[model samples]
Target: MVTYSRAALFILVVFGIGFAIGSTNLPGAWYAGLTKPPFNPPNWVFAPVWSVIYVLIALAGARTWERAPRGPGMLLWTAQMLFNFTWSPVFFTWHCTGIALAVIVAMLLAIIGFIAERWQADRAAAALFLPYLAWVAFATLLNAGIFLLN
Candidate 1:
């Protein structure tokens, strides 16, 4: 049985922490000056997209935690969240695109690992990660593009 309180707490923590970190480490003049790829979405699109993604991420995490707190799925979920939280600071504040790319790649890998780990045990958790994976893949390309161009 899923615990509503635990799910709500995970959702709030995931979304709130991500929003706080993102708001604090927003793209500034440096990001604006970079030559972005044509595929890059407008700056305004990120917040809403992330808002939805974070909720999905939280739900998957809560479900995985419920199923097996100490399992590989939870480990991958934690790994991805750590990498996710690290990217904005490295890319926007510290201005380390190469390092940020590395972080994001690791994050992408962790997300894939999470999905694979959850596939047999919890298909819903795995399904929840599909959009997150797609977005991160696109973001990885964008990061690589920016690193190459600038």
Candidate 2:
């Protein structure tokens, strides 16, 4: 059985990875340069929401890893995480909202596949990804809107 400390560490690591990726000085300054949709969320909301999602993602990954250490499901999870990590830099730092939208769309599809695969291994793992998936779907639409508005 995986100890609570390991699980906590896993979550912290995932959150840290997200923080590191988003920590680029360019994002905060560059974000101000972009034209955002009126519906765009306040800047402060992103960190908190993403923080929760990252924790969920890490927990799901730990659970899935415990069940199926070397499986396609884990690969999909990793792929989605890679996509997640890349989007912030692309959109916020590089100001490539269109390309970021494309990346997120692909990411949403990959996460769906991950959920489907994880469903067979651990239902809780699959369930845990639901909020992340939903958030990404909303994010994809937001990305598209931002691209259009800007």
Give the winner by TM-score.
Answer: 1
Residue-level lDDT for 32 in candidate 1: 98
lDDT of 1 by residue, 1-150 (tens): 568987898999998899899989989999999999999999999999999999899999999999889988899999999999999999999999999999999999999999998999999989999999999999999999999999
- Candidate 2 — what's its lDDT? 0.85
TM-score of each: 0.98, 0.91
Off by over 4 Å in 2: none
Global lDDT scores for all candidate models: 0.95, 0.85
In terms of lDDT, model 1 sits at 0.95
- Candidate RMSDs in order: 0.7, 1.6
Pairs clashing in candidate 2? Answer: none
Q: List pairs with backbone clashes in candidate 1.
A: none
Misplaced by over 4 Å in model 1 are: none
In the range 1-150, model 2's lDDT, one tens digit per residue, is: 545876798798898888888886246756777777777788788889988898889988888677777888888888999899889888877788889998999899989999999887688888989999988998898899889877
Single out the weakest 10-residue window by summed lDDT for candidate 2: 24-33
Collision count for each candidate, in order = 0, 0
How far out, in Å, is residue 83 in model 2? Answer: 0.3
